[model samples]
Target: MMIDNRLCGSWDMISNDNFEGFMTALDIGFAVRKIAVLLHQKKVIEQVGDIYIVKTLSIFRNYIISFKLDQEFEEYTRGMDDRHCKSVVTWQGNKLVCTQEGEKKNRGWAHWIEDDKLYLELYCEGEVCKQVFKRINS
Candidate 1:
């Protein structure tokens, strides 16, 4: 089935799994990593025109970020990153492809849905991190 671009709108992050072991690999302190791993993170997404805003919320800390699809721009990954990046994202089939260029090499992410399940793949420095989430409806 073909998806409307609006399908990228409003997504809730129900669950997440780290694949690149970035938290541990990046030497994130045990305390912070512990909290991050244990805490439930909810992602709220909104699409207005060609822009997308993603908000990662939790008890310990909250992060708000925005990106434009298919349009390259400077991105500052606050909370998760300290450096600046050049990024762009576009849709491929049912999946969203993201490319981030900066201090880290081979950084990008892809998002998609299947069987009502949410999938996220984050990449950095040749390491690929994958996370999957099931949709929750009330």
Candidate 2:
């Protein structure tokens, strides 16, 4: 299967659900979590060959993670929830699925595009956060 080039673009967050629970699962402080929920999040993805650079940008904090497909790398999620984890992102059909192994249980996220929108499902412990983004540029 061929990867869709449309996945490389800037997406603005349209909605977020259960994000507070997800953040709480990550042990984020109440003040930080409150600020996080109020910030408008934007995601930018740049895919070249098998390498991908993904950025989550907001006024409160910004995070950038770069990795090659099927390669495991140490990811330090700073500015957001500060944690270190071993992460690997692989392609499942047309969706990008990531698995993170570390202190938290069931920690990972998946990214997929549908109907000109980008969907991200973030899960940790029993909490699942769903975020939808509309494509701003491709």
Candidate 3:
């Protein structure tokens, strides 16, 4: 139940790549996708006991997920994709990897720390969106 301390903090998005392609693969509307691309997303991760709470924040919208490692949960991606998913997260080495199963194929995301920054790779339907975030005041 001990989560990695490196990921337990606030992070601000510094770079986002291939986000449009990723959104397109998810069948998101053009208008929503446009706004989503411009959003400066922030992540706040909190761990208590065996549970983890991850909040993806933005001015346009916000998404939150809470679960324990190695456990599956029904995830409703409310403001993001508006889809229902069976999601499970597990630790692979120092990286936290999540697999989402639903309508999309090859859907999942991973979070890891590298070069003093937080890195995220969101993928669905053969499209991968890579995002980098910097820690806030460490």
Candidate 4:
């Protein structure tokens, strides 16, 4: 359950691509989609031993996930899709890969550090939303 400690920091969104498409694939309503697309996001990742806390922050809403690596837990996408899913996160090489099992097909996300930038790929229903974040703290 060891992780790359370098990922523990504050990150600001640099670019988000195809986020609307990804939200549409999740069956998100138009109103929320519009608001979500307009807001920039910040991420704060903290780790202690094998436990990880990931916070996705924005003006409109925030989503947080806390769990130990490789441990299965119930995750409710409350402010987002409002779906209940069993989720587990584990490392695939240097990337932190999370697989969510529930109603949707191919639903998951992966975060990896590349060239000092935090890269995130959100997947659901064959749609992939790619987002990159730049470190904001020394």
Candidate with top lDDT is: 4
Per-prediction TM-score to the true structure, in the order listed: 0.79, 0.94, 0.96, 0.97
Give the alpha carbon lDDT tens digit for every residue of 1-138 in model 3.
Answer: 577889989999999999999999999999999999999999999988788999999999989999999999999999878999999999898889999999999999999999999999999999999999999995
lDDT of 2 at 69: 82
Q: By the TM-score metric, which is better: model 1 or model 3? A: 3
- lDDT, residue 94, candidate 1: 77
CA lDDT, candidate 4, residue 28? 98
Return whichever of 1 and 4 wins on TM-score: 4
Give the whole-model CA lDDT for all candidates, comma-separated. 0.68, 0.90, 0.93, 0.94
Clashing pairs in 1: none
Q: Order the candidate numbers by lDDT, best to worst.
A: 4, 3, 2, 1
Q: List the candidates ranked by TM-score, beginning with the highest.
A: 4, 3, 2, 1
- Model 4: runs farther than 4 Å from truth? none
Stretches off by above 4 angstroms in model 2 are 1-3
Clashes within 3 Å, all models in order: 0, 0, 0, 0
Assess candidate 4 and give its lDDT. 0.94
Estimate, for each residue in 1-138, the C-alpha lDDT of model 1 and write its tens digit. 223444444456665667426665544567777677777666566676666776767788888767766679888877765668898877788787878888677777887877666677877765666666654453
